[model samples]
Target chain A: MNARVTPQDSALIRSARFRKEREADWRRLEDLVEKAEKNGLQNMDFAGTRDLASLYRQATTSLAIAREISLDKALLEYLEALTARAYLSVYAPQERLGGLVGRFITKSAPQAMRRSWFYILLGFLCMGLGALAGYLLYLENASWFYVFMPPEMAGGRGPDSTTAFLRSVIYDDDHSSSGLGAFATYLFSHNTRIAIFVFGLGVFACAPAFLLTFYNGLILGAFYALHVDRGLGWDLGGWLSIHGVTELSAICIACGGGMQLGMAVLFPGRNTRKEALRLAGKDAVKLAIVAAIMLVAAAILEGFFRQTVQDMWTRYLIGWTVGFGWLAWFMLGGRARQ
Target chain B: MRSPAADVRKAQRLARKDRRAERGRAASTILPPEGVPLNLPVASIGVRLAAQIADVLITTVAAVCLVILFSALELTRPQTIMAIAMLLFFVIRVPYYILSELAWNGQTLGKRFLKIKVVAHNGGSLSTHALVLRNLMKEAEIFLPGTLLLTLDQESPVASWIALAWVAMAFAIPLMNPYRQRLGDILAGTHVIHLPQPILLKDLAGEAKPMTAAKPGAKGFAFLAHQLDHYGAFELQTLETLLRAQDKFMSPDVHARNRRTVATIVEKIRQKIGFADPIPPARAVEFLRSFYNAQRAHLEQRQLFGDKRADKHHAADETPQ
Candidate 1:
């Protein structure tokens, strides 16, 4: 009994000494990580941050050693949680407002738009085909207008409406400018919602997204067909062009972004489908931001310019210029430095 | 704005205290970039649903408030007021989800209340790209379908049924998965894990009498070195649990049962290790305490020499005698 007792006494003493030697470093790391989590890491000085990193490393090392040598359950759990909190602190995303906004605008957004060129073109193609179908169907039968557009959306401007009424509706500049704020807000909210919806539904292999964009184009064509029958086709073009170029393109690009998500899943190449989707998601988010910005721009133009401007020539020129500018921006915006 | 801190803090402390006393239940591991597998418990399905409900309530309240505020403004056109009221929650939800998660490190106000958090599934940093992707998916998966079902255009039972199916499918995704990830979580490569409130209790050493302590009416057991080698860390943890639980709060019946259990454990240990002397009834507790301290130290020494006995199986694997 005397011989057995001696080794146990010494073992207990050694374990206590080991813990006492390293406990200070672990405590310091725990304090720093907690402070950084509650506040921000920027509040700490350079020396403090350096010490935190060093202490975190030491704690991890101590934890590894403790696992092998210590039977203390409390110490083991404390070390495990401490390292996890430290890992989160050390690797947490730290985005500065200025750099993020600048980078998103000048780099990421434009680059994503450029990358999604094929999907965007495909979105436009679907829209174009739907437009052609609606236009031909309307020309074949004027009553097809009701079939293409619901009365609520058409706002009583249908095949049954007089040409005079249609023309007056397009050139209704006498509407109160005070209501422009409300109009812009409504349009921005409405279009942005549809854009986001189209983008989000793209994950089901692009069919849903493509079909929705096509459906939107059908409405556009049916409306134009009604004006054509009234011989106000070019006038309708001028009226729509002011905001249509921006709004339509924004919606299509959103479709493109969604389709990219679909494509990533459908054809993940070598990477697993989830990894591919995540990468596509990164690009798609940028495109969604672009779509949102364009929709806002469209809302502003429609409310302030379309409601007030009466000149057809000015309208056509502004529309074409903006369209070309959007095209050029996507093609070359982020590549100037490169 | 309501403080979830005080109440949750208490519950969290008790939960962690229970965790420290109990043996590990093999909580799922998160492999951080440091290559260390941190065992964090994933939030349960009920908890996640409750959190979502809380979020929905908050957002709906905000929406109703917006409706009141917008109507109070008395906009001349009813169209403007109608538009605002109709889509308030839809608009409010997206920004509320994205911005709060971004600002508060992947915790929405609801998540903060429940003490669960969105962590990267691949153990990477919680990126803004991921947060945006996930929350955007939330609209397609949950909000749109949920709203449609709630509105339930009664004329068309078919559309209502479709919306019902969509909502069911959205909810079922999380239930079917190992990580309880909804469609958004799957897309974003993120999962919600329960945030542990780890409070290290004072070690068993604090409870155990020192080897030199000469207690009244009893002498401590002198455990042999080879006898200490009979068990492993797994057994030691179980012993730690047994030693930490004092008889203070136990009911009279429970206290009697615990004493019997401890006596049985002492008999088992004495026979397994071939200890010669008989420990009296008064000294059984002390005998177990000193034995635990000595065995834990012996195990630690062996572990220090890179011979970790994870469980009782180490004897069959290592000592061939």
Candidate 2:
């Protein structure tokens, strides 16, 4: 032993020795992890699972020590990756898709809606007031209809358009299937855009959401007045009944979500604003999801059934059914558990 | 025993300190939260922006492809075609972001490319709702305002100004925040961080080959196993960074800078671990290097024997003898 063993050389020798001692356990852990990755955790028996967990704990400890000792970067990195992968597999949520969707529908959405009922009522009031005001304004002067409905949107349904032309536009089912598909897509996009806008803008203190809700009601009111003036009020009712029940309610629900968000920011109560907002967001998001589902149902009705249904009575029946179905679901859904 | 409330307060205080340290920019270290043992670095603004740019490009390309496919179908109504195209853009494009983030574990293709990932702010697994909400908000935060601004030529003057203001606020929010979080991240309680890069170990002994054999009584310092047990992974990583940085530069100023840094670290480690060895100025780097190797080996050896070490403290609960 003529050669001098400096501290650096000794440290290297010690590290190499450590590697030799632990190499078998590391190799076993690596094999287990590889098998789990390839064939899923179910492939491992109870003992194997336990061993994997124990190995993971040991590897994490090794990582801590390696860091303390300033071990080789490569060794440290290997441990880090292995530990992280194991942690993910062990701790990550493992809900099946069917279960997740079922839970959301059966509990999450309805419960959220119930929690935010106050905001929903307020949204309804806002829309009602706007609709009444619009009806009265349109009754006072026909020109107010133009103010509420844009020319592009009106599609020649302005005050200047004849009653017969308006009637034909509503009753005509002569358009190509492609045209109907395009229209359906367009209406779905437009409604979705507005719903998202109201929901998002609610974060800005709920004013925009309220205003948008009011604006939507005003359009409906003005359109109703136009139909009444043409002596086709029943026809208009039938026309709106098929899809309006679903579409309008969805908008209202989305607006409710917006108001909920706004109120959280404004009030916050005992919690910090961030905490309050986070809590409110959970309920608000569920309301938005419910609103989206309604919109999809509405789009389907308008696209496939609205034009095809010739009898006004059949249309009203379908519309009222959907409207009542939703009402029942909201009021009674998830109430069994409570 | 500390009250639960006191524990909560302590955690909050630590969190605040960590946030403050992150804002300092010059502080290169990150301290994990109470339960989370990993210390991941937050991604830089430049990397985040690059990732966002990549995502935008992908979306645009997808939109263009849809438009071309629709046009080639030779539909009778151009208005109908345009409307359908717009509809597809919203329905498909929005979900693309949500699903990508969810499936890829908080990483979109762009984020993957930049090696950054979104993680829960509270150090929990990401939830589906959080993923959906954040992506949905992207419409309001970036896309809507951006599209409005780009179409300024067609918009009313008042509307154009409002759009401009919205876009400005969206762009500025991330810059002003310590975590560089956009409105979505703030609302969703998520933030992006840089993924740890793979580390390759170089042979430390091979590098020390130039040293001559030790003369009699010229003993190099050796750290006792107990002395090496004080520091943990965090300190080890910090030292590794310093060593790596030393090898990255060749300029005289950089060398001088590295020497100063190494000396400061050596002194800090000595004080921390209570090592009594008087390391000569020239031997400070070498001494730290040797200590690092020895400590790392000792830790690994302990781990194999089913002994665990969490931090500096070798508590009985953490590492049973």
TM-score of each: 0.86, 0.74
Best by TM-score: 1
**Residues B135-156, model 2: lDDT tens digits:** 8778778888776676577547
Interface RMSD of 1: 2.8
Over 4 Å off in model 2, which ranges? Answer: A1-52, A63-90, A177-180, A183-185, A188-190, B1-36, B56-77, B147-155, B200-321
Calculate DockQ per candidate and list them.
Answer: 0.33, 0.16
Q: Give each model's clash number.
A: 0, 3
Each model's TM-score for chain A is: 0.92, 0.86
TM-score, chain A only, candidate 2, equals 0.86
The candidate scoring highest on DockQ is 1
Cα displacement (angstroms), candidate 1, residue B4, comes to 54
Q: Give the per-residue lDDT digits (tens) of candidate 1, residues B83-131.
A: 5555577668878998878776778889989988888878888887778
